[model samples]
Target: MGSPAMADGYINGVPVDCYCTDKQGQRIEVGETICLQVDGRMFMAQCQMSLNVPMWREVSPGCLSSGLTAPLQSVDPSIHTLGVDVEIFATKS
Candidate 1:
């Protein structure tokens, strides 16, 4: 798993739940996994909470395919797609 830096946020003196954001500024809820390509390398990543902070942990050794069957929660009203090699399925909330 890749160790990415994490930063937390606060609102009105209350700590808020952390969410993972991609390059396109789409928010991914915790416990969700997504295929990401960083530094020209593709990997499967999941949003996890560690030590009260949210971070992306690599789950798969490498990306095998583009189709992801995991159900996704809608964070944005507009539909979006990742790279040509990655396909994301999201349901409107």
Candidate 2:
């Protein structure tokens, strides 16, 4: 999930254990098997996945005598991808 904050946070309650030093540096652990069904076809795969939230900023001005405030924000899973070898199962007649 996405949240507005200065530091990092979790996604779907899953913790980020590893860090990468670059434009993008975050890792997520997903289960081995993923299943998808479309129309009457079923697909299964063993996959690796990731979730990312790009960094952002938000500025808010106070009313009256109050000063201005700037807060950091991030988008939830700005990018998500899955890589795996998929298998298609056929039904028997």
Candidate 3:
């Protein structure tokens, strides 16, 4: 099985202590990008940390391809065109 997004490997000796959890309760390491489906639209989100808070910030308006079973024809218009900034917040443990 393929994942909806790919997790980036750590750079030489660089360590990441922050991470965000997805809707399914999966752990997303900082700097990792993931594809998420919201309301019928596909989006690309990156895990990031802000003020010690872990959050997923939308990096792309739409996802052209996701390894999931969902087809690509399902994405709606640009998320920016909707005048909304999508962000998912997760508590750090």
Candidate 4:
């Protein structure tokens, strides 16, 4: 697969750690970029796995959820495989 450029956006509330993995025995490389936006806050990270296997993982800090109050926007469906899960949180003010 071709590596996509880094995408920028925002994520609301406190950002929780995220992980991505390929469970279909495919080769995915690290350093590839996946852009994500949650609740308006944008996040950018390099791909962390580069081998054909069954899983890739990404872990982000909680600050990615800063300044979030609403729900996340609809994500584009062409950039990733199905069944991916995201988790987020907010700090008590």
Name the runs in model 2 displaced over 4 angstroms.
Answer: 1-14, 17-29, 51-93
lDDT of each: 0.72, 0.35, 0.67, 0.40
User: Which candidate comes out best when scored by lDDT?
Assistant: 1
Of candidates 3 and 2, the better by TM-score: 3
Cα lDDT of candidate 1 equals: 0.72
- Say which candidate scores most in TM-score: 1
The local lDDT score (0 to 100) that residue 72 gets in candidate 2 is 17
Question: 1-93 in candidate 3: lDDT tens per residue?
Answer: 322222232323354455788889988878889888888988999997665567788999887664655543455546433433344344457
TM-score of 3: 0.48
Distance from true location, Cα of 52 in model 1, Å: 1.4
- For candidate 2, the per-residue lDDT at 13 reads 69
lDDT (C-alpha) at residue 76 in model 4? 45
Quality of model 2 by C-alpha lDDT: 0.35
- Tell me the TM-score of model 4: 0.21
The per-candidate count of clashes, in order, stands at 0, 0, 0, 19
Report the Cα lDDT for residue 70, model 3: 52
